[model samples]
Target: MPQVFKDFAILFKYRNFLELCFAVLVSMLGFGLIIPLLPIYAREMGASGVYLGLLTSLFGMTRSITSIPGGVLADKIGRKKMMVGGLAVYTVVMFLFGVSTHLYHLLILRACQGAASGVVWPVAATAVADIVDPKDRGKAMGFFSMMWDAGIAVGPVLGGLAAAAFSMAAPFFVCSALSLASALLILKRVKETHKKSEEKPTVSLEGLSFHKLSLIGICVTGFTVSFAMGVVHPILPLFGNEVIGLNEASIGIIFGAMGVTRFLVKPISGALADNIGKKRVIVTGLAFNGVFTTLISFSESFTTIMLPSVARAVGLGMTMPSINALVTSMTTKEKRGRVMGIFSTSRNTGLVMGPLLGGFAFDALSVRAPFFICGFVVFMGALVLIATVTEVENENAEIALS
Candidate 1:
């Protein structure tokens, strides 16, 4: 544990990386505020299962569409510029979310929000890749993920309380304010990490044949994992509320528990991935995550649910930083932005389908059907990873280490 803290502490010396972390941390806090509330909010506005899934899918659809372009643009323009611009748009979208009355308004706003995120997250990840060494990339990403999850851990409780004390609209307003602050912070504090690519910034994968198999494997793994998450997101809170007799506050606490477990686990998991192997950590994590995801269906009450939920967090915490590090280690700096963009696009594509299918399963099949299906899909993804991905040296890894 001390070694983990030391490794994380070592990363703080990078000023640009630290600035990015702070910006992401603040932005995610706002993003997390809505996680447990949005579907329920849509439901209250008369969204049926399919319609609810559509709302989530619209966000993924727009995000998937924009992610590649966003990555290409980041290589051409600048990471800092793209990130700030996206955050500025997010500020507007969140405020609009506060004022939205009809379900259609949310649909449009969610799409817009997705577009902005498509720009923001991939670029930020590319920047992290640019700043860190290949060997330490896992830890760096783990710390980054930890910071993001920390905000997520706290945001739900605060959002729930804010809703209880004021109104459902209150969290959106607060989210808007935080988005504006994050944008301004990035604009002022973060440095541009990459030189503009001298070659024309086309989003082709022609030159990456050496890493092609690994890239494809990672993207597939990312898509399946995200798809499983997308399947759960719109329905999990609803399951707690409608079937388990929990209130919004209790739902928020459950979400918070998941986040807290992620926060505690990610840094150590990242370090573990560095010492062992990224592929091993990812496979183990996915299987564990899949098992717990399936188990959530059997929980009768809050206490029963918490075990699986937190265990799921542990699996994810182990999985994501390793995935980020593996992806970073697969490509040269020149193509990192576009590669990250492609990966994010793939994941978003899964997200686009998962929610719609999950909602259909929830309403059309059975309420617990999404969980069972999600588990099966994710476990298959882990198997897919074992078959396709092999850890290999990036062309520039030794050079980076030197």
Candidate 2:
């Protein structure tokens, strides 16, 4: 209620948070600009279903491999530097994607993109955790997620139109420009937030404490949810274009609607997580997502699909911020980057496998098979959360920019 608004108000008081939001928004805009068209573009280059899946999985593979190491660098070296370097890489990769004439070029570029993401996304998340009070972490993360989703929502529409009006490569060129802008913005405006840890930076899995168990639980949940989404990612555009006969612009609009729904839901969900139980919010939202995702498999047309698509967005909006807030609550500032990196690595590992599974299912099974399997997996993730995660109320003093 009023308390949520107050917490949100408190977030705006921090310059670092605002700067980070702006940078992320623009960068994600760049992401949105080309990602929806990527599958179709690959297909145009003579890729088959399994090959397209590999193309998507390759990005996840490189990102998964790099995420833990990137996090350690962020912890030991600095968050801002890691972010800046990653964005610079992203800018270069996006530009290269524009000029790429073959599928192999895309594969190389995707690997680079994944590596950059491994550095940028976790470090940026760690920075978000670092800048806010634990009490306000949920709302801040919601806001952060919302900003990027906003960029994603608009990007597809513009990209679709760009592809229609000019060329498929047009949107990618724009993406590169936006990525460059984002990198400069971060380098200039964002401050260093990592407090030099007295202990050496290292990741381990040997602990039996409540906090450690909870971290493991959240990681499992993150992996499951991301796996579900990953299963849908490579095939969703193909389904829309091939089955429903939607043009690129039309497909863009559908994804845009989904993104908009997620963008709107995140801040509210974050606030609710702060007030109601985080686990309660997470389980409920995930259940909603799981049901709707299953329903999407039954869709026969664009009209039938849109409802479930938006509903799925609502579930994701609720789940991600709460998950992030919970993770932030579990760690101290000194180790936050590495911990976020671990979570990202876990999620990316799922991403690595999901598309492969999805591609196999799509190629070998019914067209609806991937969606059904993904839906079941998502529902199971909700149950896993209920069984495993125990919410700990963080009582640490809030860190601030001096």
Candidate with maximal TM-score: 1
TM-score (C-alpha) between model 2 and the true structure: 0.96
The true-structure Cα RMSD of candidate 1 reads: 1.6
C-alpha RMSD by candidate, in order: 1.6, 2.5
lDDT of 2 by residue, 1-402 (tens): 665466567457776898899899999998998878999999999988888888888888999888999988888888999999999999999999999999999999998999999999888988988878777778888899988899999999899999999999999999999999999999998889876556676888533123777888889998999888888888888888888778999888888898899888888888888888688889988888888988888888888878888898899888998998888777667777777888898899888888988888888997788899889988888888888888977754223211
Residue 138 in model 2: shift from native, Å?
0.5
Clashing pairs in 2: none
C-alpha lDDT values of all predictions: 0.88, 0.86
**Per-residue error at 219 for model 2, in Å?**
0.9
Best candidate according to lDDT: 1
Judged by whole-model lDDT over C-alpha atoms, candidate 2 comes out at: 0.86
Model 1: CA > 4 A from native: 395-402
